[model samples]
Target: MRKLDNNEDGNFNKKISNSPANKRINLRENPYVARIRDETESMRAYINYETAKEQVRRIDDAKDLCDEIKKMSEDLNSNFYSNLEISNSFGDIHLEDIPDGLRGSVKYIADNTGWSYLSVLLFVLLSIAAATRGRYIAKINDEWLEAITLYVIVCAESGNMKSNLLKLVMRPHESFENRKQAQHAEKLSKSNNVDIVIAREIALKQSQKNHGKDLVICKEALKTLANNVRHDRNMINDYCPVEEASALPRVFTEDTSFPKLYATMQDNGGGSTFASAEGNTFLHLVLASRSPLDIFTKAHGYEKFITETKRDGTKILQQPFLNIGIVVNPDIARQLYSNDRLGLHGLSPRFAVCFGGKQDEIVEDNSSKSDYNSYSEKIENLLEDNFTQEPSRKLIEIQFSPEAKEQLLIILKETEKEQNRTPKGQTHYRAYLRKIRGLVARIATILHIWGHAKPDNHFVSKNDVLIAKKIVYSISLHAEYAFSANGLSAYYDAQKILDWIKRHRHSFFTSTQVAKGIEKMKNDNIFPALDALEKLNIIRQLITPSKPRLCVVHKNFITSA
Candidate 1:
């Protein structure tokens, strides 16, 4: 309590600080101890500063991580939406997608038969072409393109009313064939009278001739020969002078041998459709041969070629147009895709395919009962024009307008880019891209005829090309899907997965969970199917601490369910 000198108080403070209990109170009072404590205090301040700095750095790191995650989520959403836009389903083609001229037929057939609009559209196009092939050609720029012909394969399961669909669409064609065959029968009977006269005259002359003398020396025989020459003046082979009766007129054949197909083509004057509801039967007939794609490729291009047979010697084909339209099961289509020869020989590229998906129930509309009458009338008119026109007249050439040509050029450029982007493994699909230009032009030509009142005078408009591109885009996507290694099998598995998800009402699931949920499906099947759905933007994967392989179903898919 008494005041003291600095040295005395410092000694006292030191003594007090030396005692452990009083150090807290007296340490600051001793100058030496206070200096030592200040050094320790500075070190503690440095450690506190370092710890605070580390915490601030961690906070900044966490901010960066949050931003990275946000960017990734945005990127994923962008890609998912982009893919959805790029790869639209075949059933995505709506009424607006079809041209006004053909929309009625397409919708009618689709509604009645439960076929996809794309399927019915392709069939109608093929039917029109089959009815009028060789009557019209397209002049796209300098290229003299052949008539609109297609090798279309609609992949669907059985009991899809393919036969009824075919019968309805081909009614006009069948009617024309029937009428022609009737005419042919009447003509054949009259022609047989001439044949009988010739045969009787020849028999009489031969009976009159002596065995020892030359048969030609007889005056009566010479007279009969001259009479026979007069009767031989009948025309055949599209108006070539011949003695034989004319071959039965035909537009298409369902079941025929390869050699017989060519014979029919000859009879029809170089155009025919090898169409069938049972496509596997047609496939088996065509593919039975070692080199099946040869004639098909040649005919598709309307190329001239000569084929020799054992009895017929050399048969020359002038300009053959072969259109094949078939409805096959998805399994058969996969077999076609897997055929190395078909793909490599370019037949696969020539085909336009449509995979039939889930069909909606058929709802009968009384208003549309007579919708097919207009279609039939148009088809019959085309057929009449083809048959009534002079054989000597050349094909009516369909040209494109300037705007259409520009649109086509744009499409060609885009196709080139697509070709460049296509992987090497997809050789046939790349070839398919290469063939798109011709395909578009052919479709445009057909659309021009279907859309215009006077197709012979009018040119293919830019709108025609745009519609053609829309159709071709859908078709190309289908081709890409079919050509993929997974193909229709993956599509099937994807449907199964969707069904299972719907049954169990799964909002989030793993591959293992899906595999377990699906009956008779192997674990290997789950990944590809899930991947397909993911690509389609139906579901997406999530990573979390609790669930590593978690996938959330798309809100749209869930709501639709």
Candidate 2:
């Protein structure tokens, strides 16, 4: 080997293989230089190819990471129930546990739709309440209660068939309204004809008097005729007023503004239901209006809601009853329950919350069509028995049995104890406990109506109370998970911390490291994130006394990193 010139050796790496300056080099003057130059060019080409290949690999890796982050975000939004310890602790609501009149329907609906029994049961209860809201009120322990109403939220991912569930449960109401609207149209047409005839008669009498030669006689006959016409008009008005036909009774709406909801309830015989598959969208639409949360609170308590709108003028809804049943994803549920205003304003406490189960968890179909038909018939029967097109309507009163009353007292005491033990700052927890008594009563009332054809003047049995308590307690577990900030919030924080760990290739680190590294990660958020990661076995914390606290990322996680 011969030593090359320093200038050539130094400039070789800086020069492109295809450059004009390199092509002009006198390689043929020495065979050794030509051989060396050829080898150098080949090596440069190899290096460039390998560098490009590595960059492509990095891009593929980045795409995979992006896909993973997107999937995680979706899971965090939709399937948070799977990771929630509260949902894990909750067992299924048995078919036997459901009210006898509704068990077959619950089973049928669950089988047909592949929805969980718990979700079906909730919808069933809400449907019954919506159908019978203005027609049946309960009296438990001498407390006069208006119709059984509930505020509910069902959390699930997309393609969970929530809309199908809602439609099935509300089928009876839909049928009832369609029939009523048709009947109303016919009656209104007839009423309009009667008004037309009366108007023609009055006009004829006035014209006859105007053209009469004997004014005195004509006036007397016209006054008598006018008196007769007025009497007939009064009788027709008393019999069937046009006001009833102006707007047919509405049982529920999928979505509406506050003013529209109020007007709908007014036209719906002082009660209305809000049911929707897209709960988040419905909530966002309504919550943007003024004081909608307050109106909802009032409606939950069956208080009077008086509002003034430019179009409707002053509208008063006495004993306004609202039953809400909506399905949403976990992200929306977290936003709703974590809102301080909603929690403190008593709207959050009125709701019973539950999350959907995994797709593979759907139970088998053992229910018969006859059983479902029986349930359907019962709902129609209730509608026919309670709902009427009459201008004046009545509500049947329900009472509780002595034993059931005793059970309710126990529930009351338990709720009071729980409330008293709750921390001061935890207003949502305290309010939820405080409201459990009424909730149980309402549930019991709905169940009581299910079994008996005539729920009026009948006492709710202890069995009903037990079943209601079971359902309430089961749903309350999920509600607790929903109201906690640590549920979804902690999951997101854990994701951030995990991503940081992977990016930095940290096998072991401390909370301080995470807090200092990630943006917007406060000390308050660090512990929950660590706890979540630990729960997933992605990391571990050391207990030894040391200068700095330490955590160990799992070997599996580090290997992936």
Candidate 3:
């Protein structure tokens, strides 16, 4: 204001502003301001440069990370390619990692319409590839194609494409519209063909873990498959193992003849049945002999026989008639009886009036006493004749009493003399006597019990009784001789009766007596002797009877006498 300078006047003066030289000088002198300005400029320059450098560094790091990722991807690609190559070499598709085209086709058909372009394209490509590979494509009909397509779709949807393909290969003729349709179709298939169908159905139903619904579907499918492939040939009865089929016990009826029974056995492939050959039915044979059910069971396959019953309700011993009798072999009887023991009670008595035993009394009285007298005589005669003749012969004659008894005594005395000559003669003699006495007592007891009363007042009945008594006495005498001759007394001497019997059968005993003796000997431990006697034709065991029946050795006795 004092000088009226332009610089001070309304800021219009440029010449009055501080000079650059002066400001520079002033700035230099004031280090704080100068340093602040310098730092600010330097900071601006540094910020610009740092920004550019950071961008370069970021680009470099990104490029390195990308390279690492790319290398890893290459390694994965190589492994995948190697697995594909391995699969192709094997001519089998890796179902777990199926080709894109096949997978796409299957998926398309399963969820979408069969008209999926992707599926069609895949099918065409696969067909071409198969042809190029010299693999024959199955000539499938339109229906088959549709079914295959549907099956593939189901397989794809179920996530078991591999197994489904295997099923298709196994059963080329099989086809289905969908999984459900396939399952239904499988049921109609033959049993032999069911394997493939079942596999496919299982695959369709398979989840993370198999469960109830899957199991049910699988079972049904398997059953259906079985039906489709079942063999239609009739079961071969001829070749069918007899033991496996028709092995059921057969009960022969009274009306059934031997030839018919034999034929029946043959037809069923000839096997041992429980029924006895003595009569048509098991009960008949058992009743006729009054055999212990236990002894009857030891015969081959007797256990199976007892399971069957006769038409008559009679069993082995359940009947009133049978109740009085004691089973000699309870073990065998129980086996033969099985559950059918009570069924024997209904059988009719197989009695017939025969000549010889108290005929007049039997005719006049027709009483139980007369019946017993007749039966005793018949049985006694049968036993005597059976002892005298070979197994081939039919029993016909009975022996006289005194002669039979004397002959038996002579045989016994001779055997005793021979046994006493041995070092342990006394011991052998006592043991043998005990065995013979035991046998005689048992036989006597059985006879006395069976033949206690006379038939009736009839003289004819008395005559039969005498004859029966004589026959039994003779048999007992022979049994005595047999035991003594076989050195049965040697048990006390520590020498087996069986050993002596084997060595002396030909020298000391007649073939007839030997045969009878061997059977009696069986009550003791005389298996070796029995076997030897059988081999020598001194005795033969008739297996047809419930109890093994003894017969003489000679064929001539059987044929001539």
Compose the digit string of candidate 3's lDDT tens values, residues 69-105.
4443333221111110000010112223323323433
lDDT for each candidate structure: 0.74, 0.73, 0.29
Runs of candidate 2 with Cα error greater than 4 angstroms are 1-89, 143-146, 186-245, 309-311, 358-366, 388-393, 491-521, 538-561
* Candidate 1 displacement at residue 256 in angstroms: 3.5
- Using TM-score as the yardstick, the better of models 1 and 3 is 1
lDDT of 1 at 518: 72
Worst 10 residues of 3 by lDDT: 146-155
Off by over 4 Å in 3: 1-217, 228-468, 484-561
Q: In terms of TM-score, which candidate is stronger, 2 or 3?
A: 2
TM-score of 2: 0.70
Q: TM-score: which is higher, 1 or 2?
A: 2
Which digits, one per residue and each the tens of the lDDT, describe model 2 over residues 1-561? Answer: 988799888787667766877766745666888889899999999999999999999999879756654444334322122232222235778778887777778888888788778988898898888777666777874555745788888887666777888887888778887887888788878766776667656765654554443535577777876676676657645654544347766666654566676667776667677888878656675456355575687777667778877886987766777789998866576677777778877887788887864333455565556787776677777776666433235656788889998998999998888777767777786788877878888899899888777777578999989999999988877766666555555655776787798899986787788878998888678777777776666666544454335576666566656
lDDT of 1 by residue, 1-561 (tens): 788999998898888768977767765698999789889999999999999999999999879756654554344443343222212365458888898878877777777777778888888988878876666788886754655678888887766777877787888888888888898888777655765656655654554443324556578878876665444433122233223576788877764566787777777766677778878766776566464566788878767767887986776677777788888876677778767788888988899898763376675764554667888988888877775312132567788899999998898999999999989888988989998988888888888888776787898999888888889888888998887756555766777788888787776677768766778776556666667777777777654454435577765555567
What clash pairs does model 2 have? none
| Candidate order (lDDT) | 1, 2, 3
Of the candidates shown, which would achieve the greatest lDDT relative to the real structure?
1
User: Which is the leading candidate under TM-score?
Assistant: 2
